[model samples]
Structures are given as C-alpha cells and as structure tokens.
Target: MSDRIIQSNKEELYASCIKRKMEGWRLAQICAVTINDGFEMSYTFVKDSDMDTLRICLKEDEPISSITQIYPCAFLQENEAAELFGVHIENITMDYKHKLYRIEADTPFKAKEDA
Candidate 1:
C-alpha cells in the first residue's frame, strides 16, 4: 500500500500507536516536539497506506514503543526519541546526549539561568 500521513490529536495519537503496534508496525523516527510544546509525537513506519505514517500529540503522558523486538535499528530512533521529547525508553541503552532536555541543557531556558 502507498504511504499516507495524518495529523492526530494527543489522545488519538496514543491510541493509534497502540493500534499500529498490535498490527506489528515498527517505530521509525520520533521527532521531538519542536513546535508543539513537547506534546506532539511523529512516527514513521513500513506499513500499508492504512497504517503508514502517523503523527500523535500526547498531552501529559509520554508514549514509548518497544520496536526493538521488531527492528534492532530502532535504537537510534529510540535515542532520538529521548533526545527530542524527554520520553524515557524502558530497558533501552541511553546516555546524556540522547536526553531531549539536555539538547537545550547547554542553553538556559530562563533569563536568570543565562545570567
């Protein structure tokens, strides 16, 4: 099937992720919430049009995908996941640089911190 992309609300995205996982879709990339206040999650997959590309926006909870079982290459994506949204991946090998918050760690978020 051809690849299809869609934007989903926070709750819808989480549900979609679960639904896709049940269908055995592997997690591709997790682009952090650069413009969505860390509430949006971007995911890519190798599936049919009905389940190809999905964008989920999560409000308070950070969702995680155990794609390591499906694709070993997901490690990098997992790292990026943490680096972008500050979502912790369970049992996944991670370090400082991979932490999303640390990406801006060098730069203070407040004027006082910068001072």
Candidate 2:
C-alpha cells in the first residue's frame, strides 16, 4: 500500500475524483456542512494501513463522483449518506441497508408530518 494525498479547492474537486478513480481507491466516508453561503463536502478515501489518506473538500450545491466504479463498497457509504444527509448518490444498484437505525423514514432527519 502506498500513501497519496491531494488537497483541492471547490473548482479542483472534480480533478480529485479523477485522481481517486485513477488510483482505484474506494470512498471510506463523506461528511458535509450546511452553511449560509453554501455546503462544504469532504470525501474521505478508503485507505490501507500503509496507504496515506486523501481528503478532498469543496463547496457546491450538489457534487458527485463515480468512485463506485472503481470500488464497489463505496455504494453503501454513499447510500447511507444520501438517506441521512439528503445527498443524491448515483449508480447505486442495491437496496440501502440502514446499519445505523432500526427503522426510520426515508430522510432520517425529517420530522414526520403526523408527529
């Protein structure tokens, strides 16, 4: 395993996606922040013990990548996030298994209309 890291601004994040694809690295996790100006997204790369971690950040209304094409495990992470944080994950082929909660609405953070 080798270590690789790249830091990019909002406009350069697409290049980061291409780099992740070229390296065949999977996505370990994704975190985002909702601010008055915009949203900040951070995609964490799946790293091996010897491989260095890659963290890419950007502020976009909606951003996406196809790291799933290289690493299939990423779909689960993406799907869970989509349901939790309301981001759209493209190219997901299977049902999203919610390992975090027992039973919840499509949007876990959404307050039930009847509630």
Candidate 3:
C-alpha cells in the first residue's frame, strides 16, 4: 500500500485527527523526531490498505493534544513520546508520568548543548 503524508500545525492537530477517524482510518502509530530546537511528531493511520500520516512540528515547550479520545490506544504512544522526547502531550487518557521507561535521565532523545 502507498503512504500519504499531510503536514499540520498544532492548532489543526485535533480536527485533522477527527477527520481521519471519520474517514475510517485507524490510528497506527505516533512517533517523534528530535529537531534542532523542537520535535516533529508523526501520527500514522491505516485504512483499508493505505497508510496516511499527519506530521506536526512543535517546539520543546509546546504542548500537543492527545488523540486518545479519537483512538483509545493512543495513550501508550503519547506516553512514550512524552517520556523519550519530552514533548508535552496534553489531556492524554492515561499519563504514565514518565514512568514508561526507567532511564536515569529524562528527555533522553533531546540534543545536548555544549555548556
């Protein structure tokens, strides 16, 4: 199946997710990539045989709304993203409070600055 990508801003995240869900897409995965000063979040969804991805770029301090209301299984992915990348995912159905991983340092994926 082919993959389709859609770029979205923070404000449009929730609505875009709702549209996808209404279109019969099932949430597949949520992932984040560390950028210079922020992170790029990708929400992947699958419908029929095709995969659709919604990408949103967010600053370190920016908070993203949880899609758990739309896809109940999203809490796990949101928790991982929050724990590993330090992205603030707001209103998640279940917040693991960074207990998803037992690492010594938080935000392990954050880029280090020469202090």
Candidate 4:
C-alpha cells in the first residue's frame, strides 16, 4: 500500500493513538529524525494490509507524551528517541532513565556544543 502521512501535534498524540487502537490498528514502528533544531517523529501503525503514519515535530527540549499506555511496545523506541535525540518523552511505561545504552555522550544524536 502507498504510505500516507498525517500531520500531528502533541495535543493530538494520545487521542489519535487510542483512536487507531480502537480501529484495529497495531503499532508497527516508531521512527525519529533530527530536524533543524528539534525532532520529527513518526508513529507507524498497521491493520490488515494498510499502513498509516502519525507524524509530529517538537523542539529540542520539549517534553512529549508517551503512548505506552496505548501501545506498551512503544517504550523501546520512545526510550531510544529520548536517550539519543533528547526528545524528552515523558511517562514511558518501561523508562530506561536514559540508561538504555552505554554510550559516553548523553544525547549522542544531538548536535554537540562547540567546545
């Protein structure tokens, strides 16, 4: 199926997730990328042969809500995004407390300050 994208915001994150779950969609993957000075993310869902992506953007330090309540499997990717990209995702079901990885840099994917 052709990929479809939905522009979303922080306020609509949870509600949209619940709606998708009720519509027989399952969380397929959570992906993220660094934007100019922030983050852009996609929460992909699947049902039968269809796929939909709910996308959102956020500032570098903006605290984003977690969807672990609706999709418990989301904690893994959510933690990875928060720990690596400094996405500030809060209320993760299985929060790794930024210890998901054993790397030296706190936010390795984030741009380093000029030393």
Candidate 5:
C-alpha cells in the first residue's frame, strides 16, 4: 500500500489521532527532525496494509498537545521527541520529564548553533 501524509496542526493533533484510532489504526511511531525554523514532527499510524502519517511543524520549545490521552503508549515517543529533538510535548499521560534517556547532550539532533 502507498504511504500517505496528513499535514496537521497543534490544535488538531489530538483529534487526528482519535480519528485514526477509531478507524482501527494503531500508532506506529513518532519522530522529529530539526528544520531551519524549528522541527518537523511526524506521527505514523498503520492498519492492515495501509500506513498514514500526521505531520506538523512547530518552533523550538513550542508545546504540542500530547496524544497519550488517546494512545497511552505515546508517552515513550513523546518523551523521546522532547529530550532528543527539543520538541515540547504537553500533557503526556506518563511523562518521564526528560529522563526517558541517558543522553548527555540536550537535543543532540537539533540544528547546529553555528548553522
């Protein structure tokens, strides 16, 4: 099946996840990549043979609503995004408060300061 991307915004993130869940899709993963302005975040959902992703862009340190309320397991990915890429996720059901990993540098995948 072809993979599709659903561009989403912070305000509609939670609802988007809920819709996917109701459609029998499961949360596959969440990832973040640093951009010139901030970060591009993607939440992947899969069901049967189809894969759809919800993508959003947020400024550094800007908070995005957590989908853990709909998908409790999202806590892990949300935490990873926060600690590894500086994507601020708010209201995680089981927030580790940035202690999910043992990395030394903060937001190592973030954009270079000298860039």
Candidate 6:
C-alpha cells in the first residue's frame, strides 16, 4: 500500500495525533533525525494496511508532548528517541528518564553539527 506523509506544526501535534487515533490508525513507529540545529520527528501510523506519517521539526531542547495517552505503544519509541536524540518528550506514561541506553555519551545519535 502507498504511504502518506504530512508535515505538522508543533501546535497541531497533539490534535493531529488524536484525530489519527480516532480514525483507527495504529501507531507504527516514531523516528527522529538530528538536524543542523534541531531534530525532526516522525510519527508513523498504520491503518487498513496503509502507512501514514506525521512529521514535526523541533529545536534541540524543545519538549514534545508524549502520545502515549493516545497510543500506549508509543512509550518505548518515544523513550528511545529521547535517550538517543535528546528530544524531550513530556508526560510519557512510562518515561525511561533518558536511560534507555547505557552509552558513555548522552544523545549518542545526535549529529555533531546539532550537538
């Protein structure tokens, strides 16, 4: 099935997620990329065998609202993103407290340019 991706602003993140969930979309994955001055987060959802992604850009220290309230399965992926990319995810149902990884350096996946 074809995949659809939509860019979303921070202000619309929660509402967008809620709308998707109400439409029977399941959270598939949450991915993050370290950019020059920030991080780009993608929330992928699946429905009817098709995939949809919601993309949002955030500054290095920006805090993102956790979607666990809408998709409980998002806890792990959101924690991983927080630990590896240093994107602060707020109100996580079960936050790993940024301890998802035991690496020497925090935010190990963050690009040097963004660090």
TM-score of each: 0.50, 0.52, 0.94, 0.93, 0.92, 0.91
Clashing residue pairs found in predicted model 4? none
**Alpha-carbon RMSD, each predicted model:** 5.5, 5.5, 1.1, 1.2, 1.4, 1.8
lDDT, residue 26, model 4: 92
* CA lDDT of every candidate: 0.56, 0.54, 0.91, 0.91, 0.89, 0.89
Better candidate by lDDT, 4 or 6: 4
Across 1-115, the per-residue lDDT of candidate 6 in tens digits comes to 9798899877898998899899998898999999878999999999997998889999988888999999999999999998888888899999999877778898888876524
lDDT of 5: 0.89
Q: Which ten residues in a row have the lowest lDDT in candidate 6?
A: 106-115
Backbone clash pairs in model 4 (N, Cα, C under 3 Å; residues 3+ apart or in different chains), count: 0
State the lDDT of candidate 5 residue by residue for 1-115, as single tens digits: 8699988888898888888889999999999999987999999999999999989999876889889999998899989998888888888998888888988997788787874
Residues 79-112, model 1: lDDT tens digits: 6665554554555543345544435453232112
What is the lDDT, from 0 to 100, of the residue 96 in candidate 6? 90
lDDT of 4 by residue, 29-107 (tens): 9988998879899999999888989999988888889999999999999999989988889899999999999999888
Backbone clash pairs for candidate 3 read: none
Candidate 1's error at 6, in angstroms?
A: 4.3
Check candidate 1 and list the clashing pairs.
Answer: 10-57, 83-100
Q: Give the alpha carbon lDDT tens digit for every residue of 5-54 in model 2.
A: 55555456556656866777556666654434334456667545534344
Candidate 4's C-alpha runs over 4 A off are: none
